[model samples]
Target: MNHEVIGGIPVLWADAPGPLEAVLMFGCGVQDETLRTLGTTHMVEHLAMSTLPRLHHEHNASVDLLTTQFTCTGRPEQVVAFLAAVCEALTALPLERIEQEAGVLAAEDGRVADPATAELLSHRYGVQGLGLAAYRGPGADRIPVEAVQEAVDRFFHRGNAVLVLTGPPPADLRLPLPDGERPDRSAALPVLRTGPSWREEDVPGPGLALHGDLDDPALQLACKLLSQRLRDTVRHRHGLSYDVGGDAVLAGPGHGERTLCLDAREGQEQRVAELLWEEALRLARECPTEDELAEEIAELREVYQDPRSTTCELGEAAGALLFGGTYQDPQTRLAVLEKVTPDEVRQAFAAALETVLLVVPCGTEVDPKLPDGRPLPRRACGTEGELPPGAKVFRPPLVDRLRSSDARRARLAVDGRGLWAREPDGTVHHVPFTEVVGVEMRGPGRVVFGRDTCVIPVVPELWAGIGPAVDAVDAAVPGQLRYPASAFRPAD
Candidate 1:
């Protein structure tokens, strides 16, 4: 790869057969925003792109869990103009367009990951960082103007950006972004669960997540082989599923989550979920055959050897540079892959299985087991116990409690330190005021969100006379952490 510095931003380029394709990437994305400012990065991207006049080029921009990219494919001059306009827009964004763009964003309603994968991430990392993928924070229309300005000042700048291209930079290329230091993201987000467990969610199909080294070639191959096997057995053979896919998300250097999600046929969710887990256990215990390993390697080799992948490879290198990761070239990676034995693949996968988190469609029953014959426990968000001492208790409305046995047992409590809720099943959820990440103000209620993924709803429908509880929450949580409930969401 050829490297240069243009307008104070690092540029990585490689020769390839294509009209000039350029990707300007920023290290910040959804992970950088707070729940109160969830869509700030995306809002920034839309605001910038909205400023561009119509041009005869293929161009788009996107924000994912960890990065934002503005890409374009066109003649050399067209590419130059596109990048220049993007930088100019970032430097002096059109704040006046906020209202119009918020509506646009609401209509877009984009999600970074699929439902099952997003739920797995949330279960693993709580409600911050990558886990934010599972939530829709405050609506775009509710995003504060100050938050948008702060996002731009902190992340959209020359110091935090990289330029990757399929060809050399044109002479007129200009990146006029304001100068700023790269934000520190070296600390890995705390993992909420290192689990060999399962949970039910409102997903279309079943999914599996393993927390492990993102750079492990064996684990990568294992995931690829698992998907291939699932496609053969679930889709082609038994007709239980139509699609099998997965993703590897980077959390920090050498660490992340790898997920495999499969869409199941109707009325067969439970069977498909069981099959998915059974296949994973089989691979972990028995290991892949030499031919299976070779087949995956051959497929990867085809992908890496293609000339069209030059831009993709350069983009990977640029991401590694932006974050703190080691990037291996295609040849080096292939060499490493070729040396991986079936036993190594088995061990890597088996070790990862220790941190496996499985998600199945709601209403589907699954009792999965580990290779050692231990049942994977069901995971729930709260502790199994009673509420804390000296807490002010609020019960469900008397009329509703008279009609339902579960309502009589459910209760909410508030103490000097935090809020708590006890479900009919005796699971207690606590969210301390000090750790309160966000508090959404429903019409006459409050939904408290905590750092540990515990949520306590102080809504009148659930508990009678919640005015006192709502007032207490407002007094304790800082004003900055509070926002009106999203208009797009129904009251809960």
Candidate 2:
């Protein structure tokens, strides 16, 4: 492996002597954009490829908090052609197809979520910088053509990019990207007002999701060990959950977010939730055994040594360069893993108790207390307001797809200070506007008020005349209470 500077861009080259794989990574992602410009990078990516000829190779693009990646894999000739075409297309993006590409992005957003990434980031990071995961990406309807062009000029540049390849660089490849300097990607650590918080979500099945904000490598190893213990105890010994595991992800440069998830069977939701807490409490009180640490280290080695495609490895290397992380060989990483002490792992587990955020299945309740005995707040206080007498109350139907016998009916009152909802089983919930931390417009005629403990989903059907109510609430609530829902436009 070697690193060189090509046209002022970093190139990470590795020799695998097989089919060619290439990845071009840019240093700007969602974290680089303000709420107003959220999704601009994505829009540029779409428009860049909107007119490319489909080749007999695998190609895809992805946007993350700190990096955007375009990857291709195939025979050597195919790889060369695909990458060359991408570079040419990026240089002259078809801005005329912006509207069509925006529609495509909207359709992509409506698909079922892979809760592992976005769901976790939203809760752990809050609705601030990277936490936009909780809501939809930038609303394509809001960003104009000028914004997209500016993004391309600022981020898609030689100085801010990295190209990685399994073989040598393609001959005569022309990468005519701009020569802009790398944008500063640093920001203050995300502060969660209700952090170590618990929230529920609409998911396909039952699961217990937890994440901690400790960024140390030793803590990362501890997360792996804890995940294995939960899997063994809950799945094998207790038969309460079908799957359980934990992992640490990079939130930014040198910052790691750890997540532990447990999936429950049909009737074991509550039981699994209870067991998860019990285990967490017990782990906090005791250090892992030496044998446990040894086993985990051995498993880590296996993972590091496992064979993977060169393209995949190159993409990872390129992403690391973009995010201010250095690429570590498997041996170096294993050495670090081996030196981690049991006491260090235990201390990390204990520290994690302070920053834990619990994401449980909807309708499943878990105690929100931290292991060290601090009560988590359930609602935002000042946002609450007194209801005015005879305020206009509007009961709108649930979104068409969500309208079922079991779906609850949501009522929004203009100038009433809050929302009232009734469940199918006769339960009434009053969530005040002051308590709302954020609001998301799900689609046409659908809105969700985000509270600490729950979310209020209101479907103002077409012609329900509830637009005034939404406007009034938006005006009445504090600026931060409205999550950037406008960033997410519904599919056409």
Candidate 3:
């Protein structure tokens, strides 16, 4: 493992499977102007890298609050050539173009979701101040393109940033970054704040209305666990809302604070709030014993292992290095989790859920008695909306194909393992089918595939990363079957 900083950019060149996948560049720092131009700078990157004329079959790029990553890979020197172009675009990127991009992002920021499932988002992230009220409309003045352009110009500077170039760096790979102090644009790590914030609104849905704003530091992990348990209990077992998972959102770069949210069955809307509180309380009151924690931990580890390093790991690595500002080595990172204790886990859980903000999303059948029985507000989908409403029929075969992929979504926890494919709708597919070898959950919800097993953070997004996912049945097999999100049922 050889590591060095090129042009002040941290670079890690390592030996990997033939035909390298990507050279990920992670750019993240706390800055003021960066927060402002964050959207604009990303817009510039999109225009430059995405539209490269020599692109072969596929290319992808995205920007998050923490970083913006562009991964262009192909045969031999082709990827390196593309890499040079990417660096040029990144270093000499036009501020004007970034400004334009900012406009595009502002438009996205201006979206007001008025869907039947609108309550779902509200209960999940909305009221906790984790709301997603974008002001992307033409008339919407706040968060406009100009504002973002300014921020972009002010952000993205040299710091402890890293640029990981694996496989090969073309003979000619250069960018225009003079080594020096990095400007500050992002915010600082959050200091613990006590108590919860609550809001009321009308929700439209079919089951109970559950609302909560979890303010604890463990909010992120809590979000994943609750979402998993929600799918397990509320959706699968109890049959609550059409969708029954909530979340916690740490604040954006410079504005706002972290939050938590939840929503449930329309009819049970009133009790939904109580349910969330009760669930959180129960977890705290009866914290997972070492045995219970170990079981759950095993399940989590099993989920993180990926067998092959093809399909997804490149994207993930590229994304993390580019946006997360840190390298994610599955084998090494999982080692850290193994050291966590039941006390640490339980204490973290108790601290995060106490005193949080809560929101609830409901269906058309207006619930009059919200937990506070304060009639919740109704958010409508203005005639013109981004996507069409009403439950769109999910094509099962398309989803199954993705699930059946042998590509690695993440590097395996213990090397030589991988994860299953995930669809756009956030569904986890069963890795091994009937003919193929299936992995079992050694404990709790854990699953074992091949020789490796690891705990996977069950939230759909994290589920996408099961270490490095790989499948060996070359030559595409008939992918016509469909499976449910939770297919670990008892077999007779």
Candidate 4:
């Protein structure tokens, strides 16, 4: 690989056997935005791409959890034109086109990660940072102009970008981005739970998330081995599942989550969930055979040695430079992996299992127990059994209470510090006013979201005389954090 500086941006390139491919990557993505501005990065990406005229080259732009990339494959001149246009667009995005592109984005309705992996990230990091994957925040049309400008200013500048190419840059290549500093992303996102627990969610199958060091070769092989085992046992042997996959997400320099997900056959949700957990436990308890380790290593070697993977490796190196991570070349990584033994893999996986978060399909009955005979507790938003002291309480209306037993048990409470709700099952959820991330103003009601993933509804249908609760929320939360409900969303 060769490195050069072009127009204030660091450019990394290497020789390849095809048309030149270039990727303009920025360090910002969904993780940089708050709940109120969840789609701001995506909006920025679309707005920039919308400025490009129709060309004959294959080109696209995408925003994931941690990085945004604008890529194209064409001759050197075409690649140069694409990168220049993208950089120019970022410097002065067409604000007038936001509305049109908002509709386009809504139509796209894309997700950066699968449902199970998204939920697992949410369970670990609440509703901020990497956890934002599980939430579809305010609608695209509702994303304010200021948020878009802020994201561009903070992340789209030359200091926060890197250029990766499959071949040498053309003499005409230019990256005329604005100057700025790279945002500090060295600190890991706060973890909400480091658990060996499980929960039911609206997913197609069962998934598992284990928190660990992203650079650990043993843990990486462990995840690969577990997926292979599930593919053999769940898909081939019993035909209970059709697909089994896994991913490793980078949260920081050394910390991240490794996920394993499987899609089950019909009427096999519970069985699939059991098999997923059983295999994970078994792997943790016992060492993998040398053949299994060899198989995984061989597969990885194949991937790294492929000639088409030059751009992919360059992209990885760019990510490491942007995020303060140490980048390892494919050969170095393979050499390290080849040295790992079955016992090391087992030990790494066993330690990770202690922080595992499992997700099964909703309505599936599961009582996952740890290897020590302890039941993995179910996860919920609130832990308090009752409301706090000195809270102004509102109960369901008399008509509704008389109609159903559950209505009588439900209640809403508001204090000077925060808002709280007690569910029909007696679980209490509290969202402190200071930590309120976003408030969705639904007609006459409000949906209050907290940084800790707790949502409190200050709506009228659930409780009688909610005027005081609504007033408390409006007055407590800052005007900037509140927005009227999106027009595209369904009415409450």
lDDT of 4 by residue, 1-492 (tens): 899999889999999998999999999888888899999999999999999999999999999999999999999999999999999999999999999999998889889899999999998988999999999898888999999999999999999999999998899899999999998878887887989778888899999999999899999999999999999999999999998989989888789999999998889999999999999889989999999999999999999999988888999899998999988999999999999999999999989998999999988998888876788888977875778889999998899999999999998999899988888888889889998999999878899999888888888778889898899999999999999988777855
User: Which regions of candidate 1 fall more than 4 Å away from where they truly are?
Assistant: none
Top-scoring candidate (TM-score): 4
Give the 10-residue window scoring lowest on summed lDDT in candidate 1: 483-492
What are the candidates' C-alpha RMSDs?
A: 1.3, 6.0, 22.1, 1.2
lDDT scores for all predictions? 0.92, 0.64, 0.40, 0.92
Q: List the residue pairs that clash in candidate 1.
A: none
The sequence of per-residue lDDT tens digits that candidate 3 reaches over residues 1-492 is 345655656555555555655544445311111211223434545556644666674456655434455665567467666655665555555545544454455455422233322333333332212122211111212223554434334443334345554454555555444344444324433322223333344544222222222222233344445555555665566676455533222233322233224446546765655555556555544544556545555665665563344334444454334333344565564565556665555556555444333444433232332233333343321112122123122222334446655322221121122234333434343223222222222222223221111112222233333222212211121222111122222321
RMSD of 3: 22.1
Residues 297-399 of candidate 2 have per-residue lDDT tens digits of 8887776666554555666677677766677777786787788888887787777666666666777766655666777444321233333457776654446
Q: Report the alpha-carbon TM-score of model 4 versus the true structure.
A: 0.98
Score candidate 3 by TM-score against the native. 0.53
- Assess candidate 2 and give its lDDT: 0.64
Which regions in candidate 4 have their CA more than 4 angstroms from the true location? none
Model 1 earns a TM-score of 0.97
- Indicate the worst ten consecutive residues by lDDT in candidate 3: 134-143
Candidate 2 backbone collisions, by pair: 138-487, 139-487, 383-434, 384-434
C-alpha TM-scores of all predictions = 0.97, 0.76, 0.53, 0.98
